[model samples]
Target: TGINYEVVALMAIKTELQDHYNVLDNWDINSVDPCSWRMVTCSSDGYVSALGLPSQRLSGKLSPGIGNLTRLQSVLLQNNAISGTIPSTIGRLGMLQTLDMSDNHLTGSIPTSLGDLKNLNYLKLNNNSLSGVLPESLATINGLALVDLSFNNLSGPVPKISARTFSIAGNSMICGVKSGVQPQQSMSRSHRIAIICGATVGSVAFVAIMVGMLLWWRHRRNQQIFFDVNDQYDPEVCLGHLKKYTFKELRASTNNFNSKNILGEGGYGIVYKGFLRDGSIVAVKRLKDYNAVGGEVQFQTEVEVISLAVHRNLLRLIGFCTTECERLLVYPYMPNGSVASQLREHINGKPALDWSRRKMIALGTARGLLYLHEQCDPKIIHRDVKASNVLLDEYFEAIVGDFGLAKLLDHQETHVTTAVRGTVGHIAPEYLSTGQSSEKTDVFGFGVLLVELITGQKALDFGRLANQKGGVLDLVKKLHQEKQLNMMVDKDLGSNYDRVELEEMVQVALLCTQYYPSHRPRMSEVIRMLEGDGLAEKWEASQNVDTPKSVSSELLPLKFTDFAGADESSVGLEAMELSGPR
Candidate 1:
């Protein structure tokens, strides 16, 4: 059977690996079923179709036995320390659609055998030490839409591939074929002689201009830290369904950048409340110091992400504006402001968020995250998920905003590694330590937001005394341990909220914040748990609130690194600063 073949195939792979982090600990050779193993995905016919173990910190060579599984459709092992040559046998998989081995220490030339993958659509072999000319057959794959072979030692003439489908930049040695209008040969001999003389002078001028252009290009390249948006934000090419606004219009709307119109300021820029000529109220985010590192990247990312994202629960991107000195994003003004502001209002004698509204907000936010993590064509991971980013409409419905640090995860790959983003207290431990952010990292942030909703505590309590140094997570653990979790409930609500419902929500939050990424439930499962179901009831029974776990022993010590004023709560447009590609 295919299962037996897959089981032995995986065993051979495990046998060759170093497994430094024990990520493959669950891939026990003695296991009777390989389908049940971690990272293995089986088809309906019980044949293994996928093996994804990206960003596991794994090392060692990829075993040739991996090609033994004929039914495999995807093989993703990116973002690890795995080294060695591309196995030629990989080409034997005729059904393969994705073969991602990027961001590894892989050496040698890309296997020409990969041309056998007739169904291949995405092939990413970037950021490796790979050498030699790319196989021309790779460009012949009919269905291939994306092929990234950048940041390598590759040399020779690059294949004639469309600019939209291939990325061969960053290879110093690779030369690209020129494509343009051909010169005319119909000129007379005298005209040709005159043209040659003119050409001689033109060539000298061109050489001088070329030298100047190269120097200018190097200067521009150094100035741009992340992506060179010099050509990325061309509305005619990249913008889809997103309105492009003129700088003059937005400048006039914000009343010539009046301080009174300013709503907030953060690491990225300032946000101002503006009234358009059409008398429509909108919030405009103006990138602070447009020349700063990663600023342009953030602006481009927000427009790109919000343009692609379409969800009622997510904040809408109305349009954008750009000028030589400024970049701005426009959005519908939220009259009720953000959840963080509402929580602060409640703390300062304002009307508190009722239990029903809080529940609705939590549920709505989860649904939005579910869409980002699972429903999006290329799954998105919201690296900066926080209460401040969750704005509320006048109807009190949640609107999850700020996708600047959002990452588009490939359908076949797992997680992506980048610089750490997100608020201090809301970041997951695994992400903080390894720089890898995934759907689970977002879940951790959501868990923190849940605790904030239940207890009305800021993610980072700047005013807490040294003795009360613990954040909301610590307080919840402490109260639960003392069998007084009810004490952690928002005191503003008194006894009006249902004790049973509150306790169940707390349990779900705790589960979502589990230390290990795999231990956290998916956002979809979380929604099911929040809404009373078999899983919810079973979880409630397992917790048995009457006898809670001791917080001192069960919980790890809450160690918070002070981001000082960097908490999202302090920012004017809290979501804007964290918006950008990681």
Candidate 2:
């Protein structure tokens, strides 16, 4: 039964997706009923372009017949019990976008014939006992975006693609000249050496041809992610305009990253607050688990994918470090800390997050999320959106942070299957149940933070009234039942607020927390709502207009800090220990 009918059973999870399964109903490999389900996906020519049930929890070698899906774009099935060599005929899948066969107990070196797949974007063959000098031909394929060979018994100087971008973090025997952000002096020396060598050995046009070919190769590889054929990036583009820095330079600037330099910590990494010799401050992030449990390849891929992409709402990537095992990132330090700590919960035991301030923060955060989900090239899904992840600058401007679980999907793509990964109370119900994360997941998390801002409550509080709603649903229910909705307001505020604006915010919060993901508004729509529109026309019509901006400028330099009056050392690592009037 190796690579056979058992694979059909796995498809049974969703009745709609598996309805056409004909073979597994009878376990017959030769039956016509199983043909379509065996391996399927339609192509431009009205034919299947993908199929594979490798291991499929089956216990036998794959049949050579597996080669039938020549037009296939994806073949995935590993983490199963199966044996024997991979079919060299698999090289026929010229259109394959992804092929994974990792962790199966298989034998044999990878067939060099696989090099013929110029369109393949992803290949995984680690954990198998394959042996051979790794394929050099792979260096020629520009379409490949991911290649994994860490656990295999393979050897050879890793392919020498100039400044080869890869992660060999865990494999002790795997070695290569690891890349890093370098000084201009080294770059200048290499350029001089190359110029002298070229003067002695080659004519200008011949070198030009070689340079053009090298560029074309890079263009091909980038197509896997930046797949459009015509939008090639130029090597002369100014990276200096990005104004990034080196991690080593940052280390020296921050006293070798003293503990006192730590300003914040989140799911993705630790942020150390540093002041440059010239007195300019920055946040240096040394990724906590550079060798993340997920795998170092993914770590590098994440850095590459997110770094090059820019958005004003995103915390800018000042620079990065990849020397030895050091995987650090530097970003401009947001002087005001995170929104959770900045909101001055109480002023002399009274709420300092007045109606106006809370409203502004809400709108600011929505704009940032909107930019990520709706405006970027490949839309970004910010998997985490709690108050802690929303950082603020001196002006109380919000910026989204900690994009570890963020995904950059094709502009038309909507959701992807992933394991549940988010703080409790902030995760959407569907994500928790089905593991299908999407933009709406961020919406749910944002909704909870909205409540936290208004009520000064957290995402969840078990200490609340017994029988209270266990989550947002419960919070809404409790507020609805209590009748005195005013009681829900943060006590520190003590009604120095616009009741009309406050009610509208609560309604938006409720809309976001509804049981169905479809019910939540897109961040774009949320931005409009927060920008003083459509929540309650009846209220907005009679409500006083927003105060004129003339006097607000005087409010700048408001002298805000997590340790408002306390001196430096008082605000230490145990942030929760900081004592304040609130």
Candidate 3:
């Protein structure tokens, strides 16, 4: 019966509103359940908990029948043409936390009954035609975090809501209370005229200053300036800087992206080494139009992350170029290339990386990851952490690059649901099955990278190694079990690395790749272990007790050949193969 009441309330709202956009075309009154309807979220116990219908272009008074859904916690109806006063019956919703009816044509004073909703946290009634004194009872809601009542015809003293995020600007008539009483009577006509005259003069002065600044900017924009390699120019705040280059200039730099200028290619894009007019070198990444899913979104994300994230080990984004036919990202050139390329060169009889350089790169990459996970505000999780993404500069220092598949997490959030990303063999087992990513997922990828560094092996080599049929993870575990850990070291690094240090690093990698997310050490802890913190002993003792449980019921063999050239766009098509019924 309560479900029916919720359904009826929803239908009444639909009938009252003039839905010009047909956004609510699916709200059929004949439906048996409103919980399944669009924009209606229900609790596990089958009660309507949230009704979100913002920017729906619907115009009408909010139906008072909404109060009948007593279990409602959030009622969001912003950015609509809805008119009339807010239904006072909404105060009956004791569990309400959010009440957003902003940017509407609603009138009348806010109901004092709203004080009854003690759990309310957000109350937005901005950009409306409401005219009356705001209720003082609103100040009593202790949990309120935001209260926006600007751009309304409300008068009298402002309420002290004690909210950290409060805004009442644009409501010129609103005034503050002093000593718990309203201020004195209105000012004299002459006093008011003087205030207006003063404000007008100040506005005119501000405009004149802005015009002078604009003219100076135009003059600078007309000139060409060259910056040195160490300039560290940032365009976000710096005005009149030559931060952006034309597509024609970039095209000329790479000699039309000739094969000789190509640095590397991957599933998403190809990178080229280019020298600008001033002899400064840069790496130009031209994303493939087909595989760059949400191209504009990815472009903006990469720019934002690279610009905001500044560390010695993080690649610096020089700038970007977006044309009708191309999206190009520019970064400082790394002469040593990527870790993956270096490892491949070692396999091809090039000069092998000494043990010291390998350790240095590992530590540097760990620091970059620590910055992303713990240092940045609203931390970022690099969903695609692999050897290919770790570039090496002139001195062979590691610079963690690539943020196309990155996800942002609030400090209070533990994980986020997203499409499965990353190289097939480097993905964490938990993330692969549940589509949930956290810092541990990045740690898992780093563990795979450790294996790549130690053994000089790819994460997913399809039966390439004569002795190993399973992936690098399986081979490392097998070698560790046999106590022949030295056999897992890169053949090119024979006797070049300390036996004791190699064993310890392998053990740390094993600890990081533990199937259970809770069991894996944080990136910060991993950093400590890399710096000789001696936490490997606890990891070694725990290994005997913790068995690797399968993430799914069936253990299916995944082959690298199956995804040899496929990109992220095709991951969803074959997701079922890697992600079993979990």
* Per-model root-mean-square deviation over C-alphas: 12.4, 19.6, 19.5
Residue-wise lDDT of candidate 2 within 325-364, one digit each (tens)?
Answer: 4566767789777777766545676555567777877876
lDDT values for all models: 0.71, 0.58, 0.72
Best by lDDT: 3
Model 3 regions more than 4 Å off = 1-242, 290-298, 346-350, 412-418, 462-466, 549-561, 564-582
- What C-alpha lDDT, on a 0 to 100 scale, does residue 339 get in candidate 3? 91
TM-score of each: 0.56, 0.50, 0.56
Please state the error at residue 133 of candidate 1 in Å. Answer: 34
Q: In model 1, where do residues sit more than 4 Å from their true spots?
A: 1-238, 289-302, 346-352, 412-418, 462-471, 535-582
Which model, 2 or 3, shows the larger TM-score? 3
Residue 301 in model 1: lDDT: 56
- Which model is ahead, 1 or 2, in terms of TM-score? 1
| lDDT per residue as tens, model 1, 430-549 | 666556678888998898888888877665552242234444466666666677867777777777788888887887877777666766788867877788655655565545434323
* Residue pairs in clash, model 3: none
**Candidate 3 lDDT over residue span 57-93, tens digit each:** 7798888888888988767788789998888989899
